[model samples]
Target: MDSNSFFWKIQAGTAATPEAVKTLGGKIVRVDAEQGSVETSFEGKRDFTNPTGAIQGGFLAAMLDDTMGPALAATLNEGEFAPTLNLNVSFHRSAVVGPILGKARIVRRGAEIAFLQGELYQADKLIASAVATAVVRKQAKAT
Candidate 1:
């Protein structure tokens, strides 16, 4: 479970299993390791819509996290994990069941924590954006 391999799995569309990426229908578009960034797009399944027919904000936030967390996670060495500490998201417009693009970049990272920024685009229009903080640590060992 190294970041580099994770990036490749995503790029190959053979990402691990039925986890968050699978659930979100995230397909990796690009991973720029030198810049600590990753890009993705989601299926925008209509079932994700809210009462007003707009995609739920939580779903959008998940996409943001899915993008940014992986951008940092994929940089981690084997046995290390980056878990979100906080994520602040802002909605710019309603998304109505269409293409969704997610992009994330690591603002800063170190031994303890990472700061990241992410954006969600609906047909090339910004729909939501987020800033996240994650703490890095060794993956918990099995008992």
Candidate 2:
């Protein structure tokens, strides 16, 4: 490992699940292994609409989770995974079905724990933000 290649491990099929990337509709704009950050852009499809005609909050959380989780994951070595212990999200505006953007950063990471922050943007507006805590540990690879 070159010390700055953690993110590539995920991209190169060495860690995590396929759904971690697939659920975003196959859109990953950037991954910065050296900075421990990841960025994503996705379409807020019509299938995610709530009864009142707004995008549901859980979907937003999923986007935030995927973004922040990978930011933490990109820092871990092979055989290591970070599972979310808790995630706190705040909604700023009602997001409709449209283009959505997300960016996450690993704030503080220790031996056992890591802190992450993420922001969701739509039309250049800050719509949602999240802070997450996760545990880093080695897990058996699925067969």
Candidate 3:
């Protein structure tokens, strides 16, 4: 596998199932999902920090977006899949290099759209939050 593409393996199974989350020298501590909620954890390492010695803001935003986007996407009915159309994130605090946890839930699911909210936390403190909207598309062709 290519180096950068390795991160694509960080995926959880559909519904309530757990899946392996590939680490770029980091680890996924948890990934639990209920009917409308999904929670995930990621261990931050030195490589994830910016030159300024703190977790980069883009990294924090990616965590929040992934958490929120999937919480809605995973809820699609059979033969359907959802993809993020727009994602907006707001930073409330900086996340240091350490373990960070993120949680998300579907706020609403309309006929063809879904709205979700999620947050990233460091050691139990909120660092950032995100809101996302997705368009439900027909499932892609299976390999």
Candidate 4:
């Protein structure tokens, strides 16, 4: 199915499957969706200067992984899903405490594989970029 249809299906409860949604300490919010990508946001209270204020590198990796998985799923046929095999992220600058948006987009789709690109942004500023490889799984036939 197309991305729009897939999005609608997930939103309408006819399809879309979500893994989890959580609010980590320090204005960090994350959501994992079944159809396409995971997204996380920071409320801007966390800064990088202070010892406890810094946004850890692991957190950044998690955000990218989450976004990449679902992006691959978005391009799948019904009952199909994608799992990440590899991911890489580059941080451009420190993310402020304000609202941050992470979006993942699929760049390549194949029968059993896909490539996805993700970006984390704070308002108009680009904070990070990610690329991932996903393994697409075919849906089992209903008996």
Best by TM-score: 1
Backbone clashes, candidate 2? 0
Over the stretch 57-115, how does candidate 3's per-residue lDDT look in tens digits?
Answer: 87777777667755654454446667788888888887888888888888887888888
Off by over 4 Å in 1: 1-15
User: Positional deviation of 86 in candidate 4, in angstroms?
Assistant: 0.2
Worst 10 residues of 3 by lDDT: 1-10
Q: lDDT score, residue 13, model 4?
A: 66
For residues 47-97, could you state the per-residue lDDT of candidate 4 as single tens digits? 322465646665666666655655565456666667788888898887655
Of models 2 and 4, which has the larger lDDT? 2
**Per-residue lDDT over 26-115 for candidate 2, one digit per residue giving the tens place of the 0 to 100 score:** 356897867989898867878878998888998888989888987877777756778899999999998899989999999998999999
Cα lDDT listed for each candidate: 0.84, 0.81, 0.67, 0.62
Worst 10 residues of 4 by lDDT: 20-29
Ranking by lDDT: 1, 2, 3, 4
Best of the candidates, lDDT: 1
TM-score, predicted candidate 4 vs. hidden true structure: 0.66
Evaluate model 4: give its lDDT: 0.62
Q: What does candidate 2 score in Cα RMSD to the true structure?
A: 2.9
The alpha-carbon deviation from the true structure for residue 130 of candidate 3, after best TM-score superposition, in angstroms, is 0.7
Query: What TM-score would every model get versus the actual structure?
Result: 0.89, 0.86, 0.74, 0.66
Q: Candidate 3: where are CA atoms >4 Å away?
A: 1-34
